[model samples]
Target chain A: MNNDHNEFMWLDEHHEVSLDEIIQLSGLTHDELHRLVENGALIPNNPTDDSWRFNSHYLVSILTLSRLKHDFELESDSLALTLVFLERIRTLEVQLQRSQHTNSAPTIDE
Target chain B: MKFKDYYEILGVARTASNDEIKKAYRKLAHQYHPDVSKDPAGEEKFKEVAEAYSTLKDAEKRAAYDQLGKHASGQEFKPPPDWSSQQGFQEYTFDDIDLSDLFAGFAKGKGRTHQSGRDRPIPGQDYELSAQISLEDAFRGTTLDLGFTVPEYDIQGQLKSVPHAFKARIPKGVTNNQKMLLRGKGGKGFHGGHDGNLYLNISFVPHRLFRVIDNDLYIDLPLTPWEATLGTTIKVPTLEGAVNLKIPAGTSSGQKLRIAKRGMPKHNQEFGDLFAVTKIIVPTTLSDQERVLLQQLADASTFNPRHHFE
Candidate 1:
């Protein structure tokens, strides 16, 4: 029955995560990271910077990709396509939710 | 600990070939993988599938497991006195494997010995949980008190879930369906390993007065027919507070008015716009004097709403 209150940390859309952090956290190799970037599956925070930077969304993407690579034995080439489809599916689902919420409201006479 | 039938868990025959077992595991893993699947119980199911596969995929482990044949699933069973001294059992360890108490108990001492050589530290598994907040909370940013159980090992090397309490901050400008990651706040690490991260899949509770689309907010502004034709200024509700909106004269129902920089906040102090959609409400019951006046106005009016149909 320990009632210790832990410290709070805020992460927003603007959080910039470094590439080394992604590698360490996700257990992905440097070659695999390069392949994902080459295939356009991932985008760095800045294109010209010597060290790569990533946004928070890339954290979720890397986790999903690593699992897919291990479980399905998928290569980065195929992963690129899968990432595209996953993004599309996520966008559509969000759009669907928004429309459903909007439609439930009272309509006006046209 | 209760014995779990690995073959039954993977939906494979006990005599199934390696390829067949692998195929079944792959399909089930895809369906129950916590990263991809939306099922609430997916993580637990995936853990079971993975544990089963880890044992069944290895030839030595499979043969050793088969030696304990025909025990009913979930039946309480203990290994023989000399089980650890068996040929394949001695070399087997739980170094990088996350096993249930049943398997962990059997491999406890052996796992520690095998790990003593390499001393490789394995990070803890990451955890995900969903949180809901009010749209206003998302707008203004707020703190949430969360209570949940996280798994840890006892002094006896037995795994158990311990209750934990923490406060997490929901940052401002977070849209619905956004995810935020809290680093090193998940399950406890082992052997000086780093703790795993916690991912918060955020969702906003639907508001009674407003509807959110992307970062924009929308609301139905009801007005009388005269107000729609002869517009006036009226107070409108925004996330911050109330603001007066000037409706242009001759505004039509279903017309939308945008209030810039008054919607949900975004990065760099940017904001999406709020839209107010007009809805003209008519009185259901009118007095005789009002009905007469309406009739006169309608009769005198030359506007024909159905001119195209005519």
Candidate 2:
């Protein structure tokens, strides 16, 4: 058994997804991917260079955008904004949940 | 075997145009997409709609399916001898397979005879499953026995869910909300395409004794009223075990005492500090002698806790 195949790596800068790999996995065209970057919906790990790889964290965002475009039949140009907004909404939802948990703690005032 | 009506699932008439069918499928999919919908059954509904659209969209497959004629959904029926399907003599009990698989097999059988089995390399589908672990498990690396179903098109061209079970090793000290990528642990790829990856969104089960903030942990430390005033050393529970923590004099309820490097462990032997918040517990009943001593002290002490109110 290859242990690496079952091993899990933390989502970090080291887990790099190349441009070609993302397009293949996500079924996003080369042009659609470029437009997402142009709209700032998809940001590369290093904006200044590589321009061809993204941090593994963006996989969910990219896949979600592609799914939305395919299902709703929306063009890539129109979906770039929707993707950005959806990402923001998801982030805010997580933040809200964390905050509620923190606030619900028992504060015993002496 | 139960029969499934693809057109009915998509809410389109048998004679509906391709454009109309596409529109219905899009609307249903948009409403039930797991990531988009809040409905608990959205995932299942979306899959059904997608299965229906897969054949309905293809001209040849639709024609093949239309020949089966309309039957009430979920009615027990058997496929005609001619329609036992064209992928060899293998039989399918709908319980083991699905209506979609049968139709998919029809297409695959057609492709085989027409194209001489020229198969395209189809990439395996990726999957995500959320995993919950205890704080103790996070402190010490643990193994997770995960069981999940992966949707795949088998060698026989039957679209089915392959049950996949494996023990995943979760590294120690993984923070909450972190996603772990398991390479080649997802559905097996078709042809020469690479196997899919699995993403495990790791979360810690709530601990009754401790609340985790990032790598650090906060614990409610209950102390006797005298202990709060006179300072004392008490054993507090940590992720490892009980450890002696010092409670300074004049410690008040809600005040946090930091125990350096005693919380969660991190990489390279680094550790997070623990915070023990003080809570004063006063006894309701006292002995006669204790009451007398307390009354005497009450008479002597002039400390006013409400001085700030003035």
Candidate 3:
């Protein structure tokens, strides 16, 4: 194996995962996934195609929703709403963090 | 391994009913869910609660655990020699629980069952780690060397984490909190199973000169009073290299000058814009000629900056 510190393989957002892979990773059944897609909770990259493809970012959301559904026994509609609320919270948090940093003095830490 | 009291962790009775235990687990899970919780140790607490619930919720596992006797939490104890053979617990998949020190001991050759002619394959556990990168590095893709201590099972079935080092390239246009998955880079599988993936959570280190807002970049460009009033072309540093930026005449302090397509690189080679925010600076110490000229200018010019107030 090349152990060089500088040598690396670049990864990007384009590493699309298939529907079967998402199912395996998230432990969601075909029906559950279809429900999510119907509710606009899970969006495939190409919605028109028979085989669904999703960006890697959806993996985290799918996994989290699966866990929440398992733990809380939440219905599909409730799960969809919860996912949207959670995403909104995350966006607001990021905005708050940016505003905080902007207001402070920029210090260089060596 | 140190013993963990499941009932005590959940603040429930030793003889708590299954329904009661489930209720307690749900309450605690809601309180400490890593994504929603604000507590600093919420993730760790969440994992502990999950482990406790996984064992206690299952009737067989709970019975086996009760057979171990009432040991205090954190009390080190070893299982009986025949414990593995007696338990016959279901093979816990990686998705069920994290391989903590306690679970590592419990998982030792206890759940495997021969089927037809071959052993069943158990997929490895997914691992997560946060990585810090510079803003500049995120703009222009860079490679990083990361050291990880990963768990492996010895011949004796004892779990140990050995030090491993690997390099990964962070692609350009990676935003903060974005995760990159390295497939088959996590825990080793059992019985020729596929390895799990490594999820890297990216966090950008604070940059000295630039503040990244989404894909856009902002930098403070300090200019002299004269430079602000009378525009000049000045060299500005970017991630790629320095480029000359033209400041319009009569440019005021705090005015933002845009340089198109000079910011962070996005997917498909698209670029964000960079904004140079102007800051007017004055010399702290004035020479005799400079002071005489300023005094002359003060008497000569009839410009009032606070005309609105007047």
Candidate 4:
């Protein structure tokens, strides 16, 4: 009956770590966190607040963006475009997951 | 020092109409104006255009210049002895424009003679970018690995943006609004012309400790009431770092301590002095006994701080 808790549970199942714990653990500055959110590489539970709450899944993505900018010398605008394109890839993977769940039948082998 | 073809510089034919010549000159002048054009050779090209127009637009000078023939490529293009004394040519003076070496006759090849072709590259246009450094860095020279993007025309004739990284040495005692000219590192000239220069304007970041005037430095040194009254050798911060400073006894709160030759380095003749103004900080929250001691000290002292205001 309670879909709110169900959604949180679903998010937990999808991501290995919760958002609050990740926000506390992340070492990035407020501006850096906001930059990640603005670039769409990070999505926060509280959009109004400046925080890039990253789990294990988002951690790798943030690292990739950092490496591109600091190491590979990609400009902020170019890195933002790369993040947007990468997010699309992540969305497609999620769509495939949903389609597989819908098509699978219950097994009698259980 | 070969003679430059003024007509070729303006991209006009010798028989160009006066109106056509005027129109071309105007267009070329606007494009090659030093203030407007980013081109490295804009200044030189603009001068060349103006010189061409000055000679060709005149009937007599054009006739005389035409007589020189191919020898005008620089060797035998000397003006007639009485060319300047000629009648009815007051409007066109050689002083306004840079006449050829043969015309001016200063030497065979003297003064600001220009070069042509790939052999003589004009210095490219200097590119400018700004950066900020801390006051400490400005006081004690610092170097930065600055990254800048320069728009360069590649071999394909396309304007491509190239990122250049270079170490820029910032000299010590450089003040705000001061410019450092780095020669031979500007835009590439046409047909392999000489490169241009780079100009760096210094800007100092804010400092928590001190404020700098042109060459002088000012800082507020906090002193206790007793130290101001009794005087002491206290540790003070200078642009060169901290130094032991002697404070005279019976010093007022606004008394200035001068440290000679300790401010900014001498740019022209002599270094400036550093002035440390003493600011006596009184404790707001005092113990009963401590308050009694301060009241006793104030009662005993004959110093009146506001005597000058009256």
- Pick the lDDT winner: 2
Candidate 3 residues lying further than 4 Å off, grouped into runs, are A1-16, A71-73, A90-110, B89-110, B114-118, B147-165, B282-310
Cα displacement (angstroms), candidate 3, residue B100, comes to 4.3
Best to worst by DockQ, what's the order? 2, 1, 3, 4
What fraction of the genuine interface contacts, i.e. the true contacts, does candidate 1 reproduce? 0.15
Per-residue error for B40 in candidate 2, Å, reads: 2.2
| TM-scores vs. true structure, each candidate | 0.81, 0.81, 0.81, 0.43
Q: Where in model 2 is the C-alpha error above 4 Å?
A: A1-7, A12-16, A51-53, A101-110, B84-95, B102-117, B151-161, B267-269, B282-310
* DockQ of candidate 2 (2 decimals): 0.34
Give me candidate 4's TM-score against the actual structure.
Answer: 0.43
What TM-score does each model's chain B reach against the true chain B? 0.80, 0.80, 0.81, 0.56
Tens-digit lDDT string for candidate 4 (B1-310): 2457767777778778878877787788668765447898997787677667667776756665665454444443444456433422222223213344223222111112333222333335556557788877877779977766554444533334466677877666566445454545555554465555555656667678776665667678799888887888988788667888888877766666778877786434467777787789987899999989888988998978789999
What does candidate 3's lDDT look like per residue over B48-125, in tens digits?
888888888878778778877778787766666566457653332322122354354454345443344234566776
lDDT of 1 by residue, B62-96 (tens): 87678766688877666555655672234323232
The iRMS of the candidates, in order, is 7.1, 5.8, 9.7, 36.0
Question: Residue B130: error of model 2 in Å?
Answer: 2.5
Residue-pair clash count for candidate 2: 0
Which residue runs of candidate 1 sit more than 4 Å off their true CA positions?
Answer: A1-14, A94-110, B30-47, B60-70, B76-111, B115-118, B267-272, B306-310
Local distance difference test scores for all models: 0.73, 0.75, 0.72, 0.57
Ordered by lDDT, highest first, the candidates read: 2, 1, 3, 4
